[model samples]
Target: MNKPFADKLRKIASYVPGEQPQCAGRIKLNANENPYPPSPRVAAALRDFDAATLAFYPDANAHRLKNALAAQNGLKASQVFVGNGSDDVLALAFQSFFCSDQPILYPDITYSFYPVWCGLFRVPYETVPLGADFRVNPRAFDRRSGGVLLPNPNAPTGIGEPLALLEDILRHNADCVVIIDEAYVDFGAESAVSLLPKYENLLIVQTASKSRSLAGLRVGWAFGSETLIGTLEAVKNSYNSYTLDAVAIEAAAASVEDDAYFRKTCKQVMDTREASAEALRALGFSILPSQANFLFATHPQKNAAELFEALRAQNIFVRYFDLPRIDNYLRITVGTDAQMARLTDALKTILS
Candidate 1:
């Protein structure tokens, strides 16, 4: 009897996240995490939070956090849905909008989690291959399908498509819900949130993990029409009413309120990313134009796998995917200026 249950479980392939090495003194950059500390307001909120509240259940609706996000994006409270992370919000969106016989579509080279979610929900999905330039072909999504799921400033590639192309896809698929994963949008990519008022079928999902330096808190949210958001809330409620805890609610709200800190940190990352890209180019790497906090590049003379190991030997970690079309590339996350200098210096020694 147990064998039958195990057999069913074996069919699902899970998402593999970037490596989190345990050893001390490692310059970890494989995961696209913010190298800077979170906003001062976040710290203040955490320090001031009452521990007695922990004994009681948190606000099931997360009203304060939702309202802050709504005011930021110019959406009503009813149009926003908060979750444990973007992954949780996306999972709920799949359940809410993608339970159909038709197949959903996403880029062949995109965030690895999309296919995992499709598998978990048993939602039918198709892959639309990116062009030779590693850019999503909006025209490919113009045909019939269950729905569309896209990551602006696509991971590993770190390339972003214009809003016009994204709008084209939205216009083509009016019958099904379209989800735009903007996990990297804050870096430079144009957001699909501005298009939310025009398309009820559109859903924009974002995370505080990358920009807010709050990956530890695991707060993510979505913006959409009230009807779509309500559907997600219903699905989320059916599963777990209190996805966000009291501390997360307070800290995330505080982070949002400090717009000055958010902008300053984002600018810092962007500056470092540009500087790193130049350094890699000077070392003979072909880098993509990234709008994310990471640079995707390949060296002409050095093998990517070999370079990855060489960097690891020096205790500098960057992301290397063995997947097709991306196996030759390394996705380097932008860290502090001093950290990036160390990475570039290590690469120079390795390449020599």
Candidate 2:
């Protein structure tokens, strides 16, 4: 066998997702999954779906789901693009818009997949450092580049940048595409979707995975000018015509339409996040004010690495990055109140 893989893939360090442990009794907070079940409507929609539809290829365009998303976001159907997940949406966007000789710009501590996409597509990229407070300084993006992408409530840090600052970046990079990954926007962060009319270069990607509890369905979408959306659709079709399956399109549509359930679930998670932050603070953790379904915190007296192991041994799971600046911190997903209570109790025992 003559090394079947391509030369580019052989040299790439692939993106590593959080561990999905199989322990039945463990509290899973490492992947930022929603604790609540998806809306009752999602279940009903799935039940109502015709099984024979699976016998045929899913609608390559996913027009119905796109219409639902557009209605939810108050945008026209032409301004929305759907993908298997935010990851797929982002990867397609990277392929569609970032091909210039200049390097794409992103935060040094953003979703780890950014660099992986850059490598896979062979697009050059430059990482701008987050400020000492672990927030993206949008002003730093005022430079010539192929494109820009950053999470609103950035992962690992969970701190959301203000919309005003994001606008400044968009203003400076008007000629280039500015991708805003808003996976956690429904939790509390201000969505840039509202600014879509003002900045044609801006593309905002969102997911049903977080707020809608549809991670398992693998449905994500983006909002932007019709031209940007058309480009994404073209790129996605070139790769996979049926990007979203029948089950996912129906589930996501139901989730989007159930506004009351969505708002209630989001409030529950946000409430739990605040309560968990206070509990961690009482344990001597220096917590950041997060607008997402998770918290990023560091302890004054405890070693994050050792604490992570201790929690794991107790069947509690939280994400601890071994990267620079954040090695000392832990990113904990807000789970059900019971799960969070177990985590706090375990931490109390470990710290004592």
Candidate 3:
């Protein structure tokens, strides 16, 4: 610990990102990013991008991005709030909706970011344990809280809570916000967006990273009632007035409009994911049922740490965590057919 560092920053543990090895180029899959590229329209918009526009500040409200997002989700512009990325939206969300003195509730094995965000925002939270099958039990989350936040199709586990179950949880805690982080929803799971009008306290946050293949542009948005958006806007404005730049605004809006491209790519990933899951099962891995572009699996007898390293040695990168419950498992991102073939080949050889 450095003596000059602020005492507050000293105690917090930073969020660990998915590995990004420079030389692991061809079959790169660690990050759960879209294997497909963004729509051609995104590039078209970028090619015609005016250099003169950089001279002025961008729309701080990200009105263009907001409107596009609103149209796509059937929400009003005021109900949409765009941020640099979903992580930024989440960061602001922690401060805006979850800063209450009461302890927040979340699945213990959920996204690692929740705990990190809590510490970063000086918010106290309690983690509810997942049931024996490693699934989030909504009944266990029965607690008095400032709010609840979790990833649908939960990260690393790749399992989703059914809509009816989630709504029951929402009904149980109407006073506080219930945030559904649907970063990977398009892979298969139904979105909680449709439930928005019914639950004003529900905030559905999504990213352009996974399903939209625009991770580099850093676009994320949240949809809720105007009041919730108003709270987030106030927090965001105080933090950064111009979060979304001109290029990002244009690209994200254009990407949302290209439904054909997005839908096609999503279908490809889901199909490939099903094929890969079957192959993993045949090779002795127990895979969680997933509705995302990644698989959470572990070999019944093999060490996950060893498998992660073995694949990395062959330039095939995947995510492995040494935490409780998931230590034996690996989170493998869905890549193209050719990439998956190579991954399976590496696993076959290593396990042989």
Per-candidate local distance difference test: 0.93, 0.92, 0.90
Model 2 Cα lDDT, one tens digit per residue, 241-328: 8999989988898888899999999999999999999999998999998999999989988899999999999889899899998899
Model 1 segments beyond 4 Å from truth? Answer: 1-5, 8-10
Q: How many backbone clashes does candidate 2 have?
A: 0
Q: Pick the candidate with the highest TM-score.
A: 1
Off by over 4 Å in 2: 1-9
lDDT of each residue in 1-352, candidate 1, tens digit only = 4575675554889999998898888998899999999999999999999999999999999999999999998889999999999989998999999988999999999989888988888999999999999998888898889889999989879999999999999999999999999999999989998999899999999999999999999999999999999999999999799999999999999999999999999999999999989988999999999999999999988989999999999889999999998898999999999999999999999988
Write candidate 3's Cα lDDT for 125-186 as tens digits.
99988887877778876778989987898888889888988898999999899999999998
The order of the candidates by lDDT, greatest first, is 1, 2, 3
> Relative to the unseen true structure, what is the C-alpha lDDT of residue 48 in candidate 1, on a scale of 0 to 100?
100
Least accurate stretch of 10 residues (summed lDDT) in model 1?
Answer: 1-10
* Pairs that clash in candidate 3: none
Q: RMSD (Cα, Å) of candidate 1? A: 1.3
Q: Between prediction 1 and prediction 2, which has the larger lDDT?
A: 1
TM-score of 2: 0.97
| Candidate maximizing lDDT | 1
